[model samples]
Target: MSEPILSLEAVETDIAQYHILKGVSLSVPRGQVTMLLGRNGVGKTTTMRTIMGLLRNKAGQIRFDGAEISGELASSRCRAGIGFVPEDMGIFSALTVEENMILAAVSGAPDRARLDWLFTVFPPLKTFWKAPAGTLSGGQKQMLSIARAMIEDRKLYLIDEPTKGLAPAIVSTMVGALRELKRQGASILMVEQNFAVARALGDHCVVMDDGRATWSGAMADLATDHALQERLMGLSMEAG
Candidate 1:
């Protein structure tokens, strides 16, 4: 669409001597959640790491808001509005929920309206504001991680396995929060193994296999294509 906010053209990444992402190409359209799905160990996390400059791309290009960002350092990428929430959720264990949120505060005063918006989306975080992050449950910790990311004024967010270890109810809450992020015009690239959660939050979808993109289309199309689902994701609603 409207000039993708982020574009990865033939991106290749390696960990030591191993080539993990072999010529993967994808684009994150502005204001949409582009779900990157694949079985475990399929280079999904590597893709996110490469985008954030945590890992360098051996080949191809990465462009952010129309400018090439492939060669930038991790901090440079962060400064360029690329926010990331790793699978570990990266919350400081000793810090209180409010302290964790404050650590992400930038030049601006952490956008009071955005913090309020996050509170509306994740009520559990609001309740745990004064508690230590280490004391919160897995789901609550995840909410704090997401809230910290939103405290920064970033245009793009790269989130990995956001619903991994939560209860079904909390998973639904996470889905709703991500949907609201899209409504607020934030572009998201999410790597998810939970198909139902992906379908609920994604507008576009890409399935990666063997370190490369094997399928890409609108999420609605993928939903109805049972054959494609089995072949690519090895999943379907009936089987689950």
Candidate 2:
């Protein structure tokens, strides 16, 4: 197995006097998609925020690329090659799709090859290149969000709920795009509510509950163990 590109050891985070994470720990292996799975309000989003330094961990360590970054700023973490796509998608709604892509480019000018590749993955972005991001559909907005993150190369991507509220066709498109990204050696730590998408993309899995890791194993193991799914996520795959 590849070494972890990101690792958290006994991480804890509190939000405005409310404890959101209590001793959360997990490893995102290099070049693999690690799915963070759990029921609602189980600290999955909080964990992602803590990893990106959007929320600071009150205790324990966060290591990225073999260096300790528990005290680093969020901007510093971004410069260190961590890309984040929040649950809200975080696009500038008033901006044109092209403008959003431009801003996401680290050098202020996107590489042509990478841009072309993204256009291939999401054709709607190319079609609506000049349209306001707010004018696009929900799925299109999600595509734009992912495209922005991919505009620049990064060591890892932290994506939250890419398929939420999307149509099945759009979800299929996202699955294809993400699969291609994995094929191109992108390492991703994604929190997805869509079990089908999670099953399709995840190489490893971490189940969180009440702000702590309740289980960790290969995706294949979790997929086959129906009882485990019920125990961790409160629903079996068939019922979910």
Give the per-residue lDDT digits (tens) of candidate 2, residues 1-240.
Answer: 666999999999999989999999899999999999999999999999999999999999999999999999998998899999999999999999999999988766999999999999999999999999999999999999999999998999999999999999999999999999999898899999888888899999999999999899899899889998988887986753
lDDT of each: 0.88, 0.93
Model 1 segments beyond 4 Å from truth?
Answer: none
Model 2 residue 16 lDDT score = 100
Candidate 2 TM-score, C-alpha based: 0.97
C-alpha root-mean-square deviation, candidate 2: 1.0
* Model 2 per-residue lDDT at 215: 91
Q: Candidate 2's error at 139, in angstroms?
A: 0.9
1-240 in candidate 1: lDDT tens per residue? 399999899999999999999999998889888999888899999999999999999999999999999889988887778888999999999999988888777555677787888889999778988989999999999988887877776889999999998999998888888887888888999998887887788899989999998989898888778888998977784553
Model 1 residue 117 lDDT score: 83
* Runs with alpha carbons beyond 4 Å of true place in candidate 2: none
Question: How displaced is residue 121 in candidate 1, in Å?
Answer: 1.6
**What lDDT score goes with residue 40 in model 1?**
89
Q: What TM-score, over all chains together, does every model reach?
A: 0.95, 0.97
RMSD of 1: 1.5
